[model samples]
Target: MNTVKELFRGNIRQYGMVIALLFIMVFFQILTDGILLKPLNITNLILQNSYILVLAIGMLLVIITGHIDLSVGSVAAFVGAISAILMVDMQMHFVPAMLISLLIGALVGAWQGFWVAYVRIPSFIVTLAGMLLFRGLTMIVLDGKSIAPFPKTFQKISSGFLPDAFGGKIHMLTIIIGIVLSLILVFSEWRKRSTQQKYGFEVGSGALFALKLAAMVAVLNIFTYVLATYEGIPNILILLFVLIVIYTFVMNRTIVGRHIYALGGNEKAAKLSGVKTQRITFWVFVNMGVLSALSGLIFAARLNSATPKAGVNFELDAIAACFIGGASASGGIGTVIGAIVGGLVMGVMNNGMSLVGLGIDWQQGIKGLVLLLAVGFDIYNKNKGVS
Candidate 1:
């Protein structure tokens, strides 16, 4: 009890946002007359927000580097349009077309990175120009019209679910997978804690650790159950899961990750310390491009079409997710999990408002309000010198 209290006292904002997410979920689950958590709706929510979550991961890195990419939305749209032209118009194989689209995305990132990292242009200016450039290119590629009905194989990337080999209506595969994942997660945490203790690193109390572990395991199983009752897991969910794990590892454990934090914390100081600031910044943007491209592909697959407006306001959503997830505005602080939870918050708000029959006008207003409050809270905390 004391340890849990200490943890909260030191890091209330992170846990607080998490609790707030739960509260929002409950509120919507009730306001929608339980429709929000309906098996089908849960699946829809995953599909609807997967791309945003992907964008958020890359956005987190960019933010931690004390820069922003305003063109991810436009880049994604451009990539989607290119993908459609390659696959549908040119009749190229889906796999090769995807590679080509990704390559284009990387090239675009390199282009922006060159300006920001090498030429010393502000990221804001570079990506803003990219926003306009790619948007125009998307229009040109699609000829200012929507492309449609991608090959079934491409569409399956977003809509398909894993086959249930358990051969039961309850999705035994899902349940089994859930249980195994939960156990693995818990065991991994335990081992990590043990290792930390051996190294004399800071470790939380057993009681607090147990409490946190149980909650996570429970949520894992419950979420799995919800999906199992519907149609098992969407393929996008698998991709999202893998992405989350990989990014979390990179951010928490890698030297590059530490360098990014150093740069965001104090760029001049990091450079003085012999960090390759320019190269790091350049690669960060390149990584952002790759992610934006992947998201573009997923978004196009979901819609079965590409349009000039396919990525409208996507950058804003990704940025907002990072801020709402407890990222510091000035950078040097954030977690991949926080960004994901933030994306979920954004997704829930959109879903809940629509379910309650709010007009599009009201939805936008409400979303804007949420973004304002989130950033405002962060600014307040920083001023107060809270962790």
Candidate 2:
């Protein structure tokens, strides 16, 4: 009984968002008369939430280091403006414009990182200042006007679907890819458990393991089906996959990832252990800046324009998603998957409410209530030792 209870606890955090997702999916399906799960809408939903997922992954790392980044939305706006200016005003090539915008983002990150890490300023303060500074710069750079009509190659970053010519209408192929990926993930999990078992560490129960894998496979197959039925997967989804793989590896396998978790768990201990807490903090922000810039570029590309208000209130969405996805407000405990789940929850709610013809005011109120519930439940679980 104790083993079973512990297994449940260990897996609770992993499944909470999944459960919430299903609940929302069912509710919306009923409300929309089953339109919510229409393959095309499902495909669009994934694409729509892709930017927040990107930001949340980076933000999760930053938060895991006991820091926060409030400047990402503004940085994205600045990057969008820069990309537009380069391509439109200067007639620069797409590749060069992208590189230059990304470089500017890196430099901006370095600036804020230096202040927070080396100058001993609080990250919250430094990034808050950056928030204002970058927003103003975005306005100045774009001269308070929207820039439009980016080149097709540049605009394709967010709006393009994968070329069906390469793999033509093959839902079976997509399903096969998902199955292979699932198998790889399952084998990896089994190896890790076996290693732990060898060391006399308790592994989760067989039941729990089966439950987790089954859930993963179900979701993966459903997602694959949706994309395959629609546009055969988006280019942005491919980019998101690459990022997830890279970031997951970095967070799980790399020394930097370890240090970040350590810093979040205990700053003084991490500093004493030669973890270079300050440098890690610095790089985390730098990375956040880069991802923000990328998100901004994609947002601009998706709209085929850069506007003064392109990223208004975007930071709140990212932060809310992180918190809702199981990030501890007190810091140190969260996952990339959690953030994505949180973003999806928010995205789904938004999409569903719109489908049901909820006015903007009601939607905002409902979303706020959901956020409160999620964070409140997370706190309750922590205090109750439920997870």
Candidate 3:
């Protein structure tokens, strides 16, 4: 019990943020007269935030590695334009076009990575240049036109929902998926606890662990139920889920993940320790490019078109999500789950404000204040520790 309390004491910030998220949800749920968590609204929430969440996952890593990619939004727009040109203008298949676009994105990553990791340029400058470069390239590719009315198959990527094989009003598939995921969550938590105890590492108590697991199961089941009542699940939700799980593993359970943390903690030290700082840094941007490209496709599909202005301010959004999720301003900290939660915070606020018919003017101001407070909170805690 004491160990569990100690764990909570150490991670008060993360848990506090989670509590804040819940508080906001409940507040909005009441303010909107229960429209906030309606089945339809819940589905829309996932779909709306799916692309940003994807970017957040990548941004989390880049920030952790002590860098930022200002070019992701432009990269997404450029790749999305290329996808439209291939599929619509040239009448190519979406799958092949998607593959090609992803490759191009990777190459773009490699290009910027070369400048940052090898040539020793600052990331902000490199990606800022990349942001302009890709935006210009997107306009040139599309001739400043918005390509629209994608094929049914392409549109399905964003708008399609999983079909219920059971054919009942209650989404049996969603519930089943929820059950499977809950079981996995339980098993993983138990194994992790056992391993930590075996190694004499500090761990939350078994009861705390159980309670957390129970919460996870409950939330998963509830979210699944919400979707089950509506369209079962959005296809993009699956993509986001896969990404979150993969990234969570990569950051928590892999050697590369450890190396990233090391580099972020102290670049010179990590290099002396043989962390291959350059290689890791180079690959980080490459990964960002790939995700940007993927997001471009998803965003374009959702809109049913590729617009020249498709990705305006997307980088800002991604950066905000990372920082709001508790990523340090100086980097070397943050988590995949934190990024997701942060993005959701942004998404929910955007949604709730819109539901209340607030103007864009007020929305932007409120959001800005939230971001400021979030970062401010982190800075306060940081300084307090030193004091």
Candidate 4:
């Protein structure tokens, strides 16, 4: 019982958001007459929220480094417009067009990063300027018009699904993949626990560990089953999974990640300890730029067009997700998984309300309230910890 309490106390934020997510899902499921978790809706949920999730991941890093990027939405719009010019107006291949767009994103990042890192400008001010600059550029690039009918290959980036290897009513491949993932998750957790025990670290009880593992595996399988019943897993889901895994590893296990946390925690101390604060800060922005570009591409692909308002207010959603997922508003604290969870919370709420015939105005108001409550919750926790 004591170990359980300790475990819960140690990971309250993570466990809390997860429980909240499940509770929200259940609440909506009941209210929607079981339509909330329908396989089709679940698939749509993933597709609709993919771009935001990507931004949330990148935004997590920025927030962790005690900074924010207000220009991601505009950057995304700009990149999408450029891609449209390359692929549609210029008749270029989607692959090369995408690569060029990403490169442009890097350049944009470098531009902003230079100001923030070297010129000693506040990130807020720099990105605010970038937001306006990029949005205007997007309008200029597209001539204030929308472009459409992206190549089918490019369209697949957002809309395509994995082909079924076995001909069946249900997607066997998805099921197999689910099982494989479950096994890997279990093995990894077990190994982590064993290592902690070996190192004399505080570890949860066997029963508690078993319970957690069971819950995770069950959720993973159930999610996969739903996808299998539909059109199977999406290509974008694969991309998201890969990105999550990579960023999670980078944040949790890498020296660079530690340096970022250190820098966020205290720039002075980090610099004194030989961490290249300027370089890290610059690269982090560069990373954000690339992810923003990718998100723009995905959004453009989904809509089959690059519009003037392609990424309007995307930065707000991404920022809100980070905070809701337990990121500290003052920075130096957050996780990649937490940001994703936060994004899902918002996505689920949006879908649920839409299903319930809620007005858009009310939806926006509710979301604003949720964001406030989430940030408030974080502040409350921080104060409690300090006290």
Off by over 4 Å in 3: 1-5
lDDT of candidate 2 over 1-387, digit per residue (tens): 787667657767766887898899899999999999998898778778888888888888878777888888999999999999899888999898998888888888889989988898888899899999999999999899999989999888888877654465665566666778888878988899889999999787888778877877788887787777767768898899899889888888899888888989999999999999888888888888888888898898888898888888788788888888988887788888888889999999999999999999999899889889887988899898874
Clashing pairs in 2: none
TM-score of 1: 0.97
2 or 4, greater by lDDT: 4
What is the per-residue lDDT of model 4 for residues 255-274, given as tens digits with 9 covering 90 to 100?
Answer: 99999999998999999999
Global lDDT scores for all candidate models: 0.93, 0.86, 0.90, 0.95
Ranking by lDDT: 4, 1, 3, 2
How close is every model to the real structure, measured as TM-score?
A: 0.97, 0.94, 0.96, 0.99
Residues 173-269, candidate 3: write the lDDT tens digits.
9889989988998898889888889999877666777788888899989989889988898898888888988988999889999999898989999
Q: Which ten residues in a row have the lowest lDDT in candidate 1?
A: 1-10
Best model number under lDDT: 4
The sequence of per-residue lDDT tens digits that candidate 1 reaches over residues 39-71 is: 999999999999999999999999989999999
